[model samples]
Target chain A: METTHRSVVDAQDTFTMAREQALIEAAQAGDKQAYRQLYDRYVGRVHALSYRLTADQGLAEDATQEVFIQLWRKLDNYNAKSKFSTWLHSVTANITVSYMRKQRGWVHRMFNIEGSAAEHHTAEGSAGDVDLEAYIVRLPERARMVFVLHAIEGYRHEEIANMLNMAVGSSKAQFHRAKHLLKEWMGYTDE
Target chain B: MSKFEQQLNQQLHDLAKEKAPQRDLWRGIELGIEHQHDTGTVPQNRHRRLAAVAASVALVVSLSWYGIQQTSVPATDHPTGQALVKALSNQHEQQKQALLVQYTDAPAMTENWEAQLAELDEAASAIKAALKEDPNNGALLRMLQQVHQQQITLIERVHAPQWQQI
Candidate 1:
């Protein structure tokens, strides 16, 4: 069983490497089909990252497409510099933050210029009542971004600061504020 | 251990895995590249220019197989027109320099006499050449007339000093 599992893992690894190489070559050659194949392979994770940060389905989809378009235009810049996945993750974060800033069509920008803003983010539960997702979608943009990156993506506050161009302390403070807002939104009473 | 944090994290997991836009939207990207190639814009790849050219030609052929043909200007004609325009512009500069050298003592009346004439000539030649292939093209005819009028102005500039000032 162990030997079989090892062979399976090896085969899968080799397949993945070969597939990635082929897609990269095709994308370099200006083959949109190869780019689409690559988009299919990574877009799920990219969407998840986008949706988590933005909490808007439409916005997430738009960001995903925009990200891939950049990937296509900037393929030569990739340089195998870091792992493709990490590079993609960085792109996702950058795109999501920009989308958040541009939400509401240039009016009532979500982030407040005060000390901090608090907001909620939730997952799945009963649909009829004010469930988790509805609450999360209401969070102020910056705090929500920090919370999503910290809790969902498991990034440290310093890393979040670098991605967001904010101070590490500010990122940590925003994470707490986001959690506090979620507490308020969820109506989780303390005894 | 706040309930909000737990719920938010759960919601995030549910949210992250949702469906994204279909992959087919990228179909337009390659089409855009082909359009650019056929329009005779220089390909950007410097290291593998031959490969880029071959790939662009292959793309045009393959895409044509699917009934999406590029406009039927011969490949040679497209590049030659582009090259001719470039060469004529260069020649216009040289003509301006030659006129300056030849007519140095003749004129102070018109500052850009040579440039004006060369531009008119270039424009007229382009329009005349275009109208030969596309006689019924109203746009080409209008352009040709515009070039002819422009050339008349250049003739006036060239003779301005002899007739008016000196």
Candidate 2:
């Protein structure tokens, strides 16, 4: 629970952004110390997203490690046009999703033998007691991925469709499915 | 949108964006990156190092046994050239078996290594025969040692071609 956010102090935005770009440049030139500074600044954000998407802490930890390892090699691909955070978040999301998909076969075969309920996670706490994070993990797998990408991470339906390799309609359907299930679980029946 | 829907949207926006994992993850990241870069070399280099030590140990044992046998010979009695050849041949056979067993799994660069070894063995036999006529000749004994050394060197090279000269 490292709390990091963009500066509320708009006056410092220019200087902060410049320093960030300088750090990125140094890291791209193979400065591991600079890369580490980037890692410290960004790891928490990456971990949170990874955990939300995978719903498994160990998998999230692995995905987070892979993200930075991939970043070190692909640093040069950072065109620096958009914010580096935006670019890196996409990278993190892609790697985490890919990691999950690699396990998808095992998940698929398991569900074939057992019902989907066996694979589905349910938060033990009552709706009022449990936090949203617990509830997020309880959604159906594809729906959870869709909702986390679209609602929480702020990727649009089209972007999520592309990310998840589904039709745009399918992405929206899954998001609606996720939102509907979550609202029902949280005791918000009135729409 | 319903008030609840808007509330949910706001909650999603306000959701914690950063969650620190229970453990530090940088060490693993560093190792992963370094390991990828050294994927072919690191473990292979370690295996080579281990094999080099084993080869050296085998050679040392063989030479030590040879030394003990040499000392066991009575200084007053003139040990025949055949006796010295027998000792050298026995040590070479042991060393060759050890070297071949160590390198069985590895590939040898030269296909005709056995033939080359046969030629060296033939040369050693000829040198031993010549030694029969001249048991006291220093040059013949030196030549016999040289032939054995060449065979060992050849075995080492063929098995571990990347090995640096010892």
Candidate 3:
């Protein structure tokens, strides 16, 4: 019975993939409706990642809007070598980083300035906000970028290092620092 | 890591990756997508119009200038030489006016495009003055013709989406 259920799920997955490929091709051909469908499908994921990385609602919205705009122009660059979601998530991360850099401006980026651990995170009184996500965003700026890209987004430390322009050791250190801070913020006291 | 700490790590991995924003972001994205589609050129049509205009101008400049060179005619001394300069200058004026009219309904790509045009006009005027004195010089005539092309090219180039963004 389990095997039969797996076959059905596999068939459904194939259908979804075929449909998504068609949508992508249509979008590449400049079909706005197809592009709109792609936007609808990916906007939530893009906004989620943007919010986590920037830790500011307003910046997240601006970033989300910019991501889709960029995606529309860049659709022709997307190939089938990777899953569409994977490619898009990578694009979203890169664009959000660029958007954040623009918001921070070149001066801050040159000086490697970042906010404190407690800056820009909302109070936890709001309903339906995930505790872990809230805590992750509260991590210091570089640490949050390193953690979100490495841990949650499944980027290797080396790749994170390249993306963030940090040394490999710095990326690993930031990831560990982010993990330690998250543990403390979550009240995990075990050795 | 302890068992509870391991659970915390697992929880981090288990967090849902999708969270719809409190606002409807698609509208903004859709508007953005539309705006991009407008500014961006379609691949097949990329620069086709500008290329056609430039090629036509080149053909006209080369052929007309060749006719003058064949006679080895001094421009101020020969009617054809003087006429050739007038013809080329008229063509340049027409191309510039055409480009300006084409983009007249649209916003100017830069505030100084007109000022830039005036500067080019000054350059063309100086070239014409030199041509009046050294009318038989092929290089001077060539320079005059090329400057006319430059004015047309500048109008089209700046009006295209290729403007330097702030």
Candidate 4:
């Protein structure tokens, strides 16, 4: 059954791979149509990642636009060594983290926002609103990024480290710190 | 690290698995791209209209100049050069207008590529600077490496051989 499922998935994967290749080729050749098709394919995932990072829908939308624009121009560089999604995720992660860093500086400069450890997470809301995302967003910026990519995105620490430009140890530490912070904030006395 | 972490991971995954955003941006993106392509080419009617206007003006000026020359008018006083210069100026203005249309219609094609590249450069620079501030910034270093790899790949693409159409 797994083989049958695998075969089906593989067939779908093959189709997707072919489509990605065609789009990349066209985009590299400066075919705006192909570039737009590719953007349509991944814009949501990128936007979701951005939203998770920034915790602001508006910022996420802006970052999503910015990231895709970057991806379109940089499509020439994508060699088929790894999956295009992985390369895209790397770009998304880098862009979002960069945006977060800039936001941190901006917020600090514009307003005297200081780093604090205590956060009161509300658990009583719609499933969409009161969820792990809210908790993840409350993590310190770097740790939150690591947590989202690793725990959420299922990337290994090494991959997370590479994507975030952090040490594996730091990535691991951040994930733990994020989890601990979440657990504390949610008042998970059962744990 | 614990069952709590495991649960947290599951919860995070569930949150992430929410439906992706609507693909309306795709339509906007496609329109933007088409607009760029349209602007890149000169509209035939506009070009032809300008050409006809210039020709008509030149015809009138030539008729007047011929009449003046027949009257033994000084050649230097003739506005032939000025009229030709004005026609040339009009042609330049038409070209400029076409360029402006191309630019305004599809701004992404006009300026976003460089802006994206500059953004990537700034990202790379930030990672490097962060690394400098904390030499053991493994996360920052790893990100820098990815950025470096990406930057190199982009440069290669920009310099890559253009594909030939059959």
- Considering the two chains of model 2, state its CAPRI-style docking category: acceptable
**Deviation of model 4 at B113, angstroms:** 24
For candidate 1, give the lDDT. Answer: 0.58
Candidate 2's C-alpha lDDT?
0.72
- lDDT per residue as tens, model 4, A92-169: 878877766654564455556533332444444332234676666666766777777876667889987887677999
For model 3, how does the per-residue alpha-carbon lDDT over B1-166 read when each residue is reduced to its tens digit? 6754576667777888787866555554554455344323312223566568766776666566655655665533446556767877887788778778998776656677667667668767876775565443333455566556656666766677645322
Model 4 CA deviation exceeding 4 Å by range: A1-6, A114-118, A121-130, A154-174, A185-187, B17-166
Q: Candidate 3 chain A: worst 10 consecutive residues by lDDT?
A: A121-130
Q: Could you tell me the lDDT of residue A89 within candidate 2?
A: 91
Q: Per-residue lDDT for A1-191 in model 3, tens only? A: 99999999999999999999999999999898988888778778988999989887756877887787788888889999999999999999999998888656543555566756474444443222237877877888888899999878899999988888889999999888887776655555454
TM-score of candidate 3 on Cα atoms, chains taken together: 0.61
lDDT of 4 at A96: 75
- The alpha-carbon deviation from the true structure for residue A114 of candidate 1, after best TM-score superposition, in angstroms, is 10
Clash pairs for candidate 4: A77-B153, A165-B139, A165-B140, A165-B142, A165-B143, A166-B138, A166-B139, A166-B140, A167-B138, A167-B139
Per-residue accuracy of model 1 over B1-166 as CA lDDT, tens digit each = 5555566556666653444553343433333333334324211222243345434543443343223223654544334334333443454345446545665566545567556566656656765565445332323333443344334334334544554434
Q: Flag regions of model 3 displaced more than 4 Å.
A: A106-113, A119-130, B40-166
Candidate 2 on B22-140: residue-level lDDT in tens? Answer: 65677657655654563332112223544565456545544554465457765632364456556667877787788778888988877988887887788678766766654433334
Model with the higher DockQ, candidate 1 or 4: 1
lDDT values, one for every candidate = 0.58, 0.72, 0.72, 0.58
lDDT, candidate 2, A33-89, per-residue tens: 999999999999999999989886766877787789888999999998999999999
Q: Residue A128, candidate 3: how far off, in angstroms? A: 18
DockQ of each: 0.15, 0.27, 0.24, 0.11
- Who wins the DockQ comparison? 2
- For all predicted structures, in order, the TM-scores are 0.52, 0.61, 0.61, 0.53
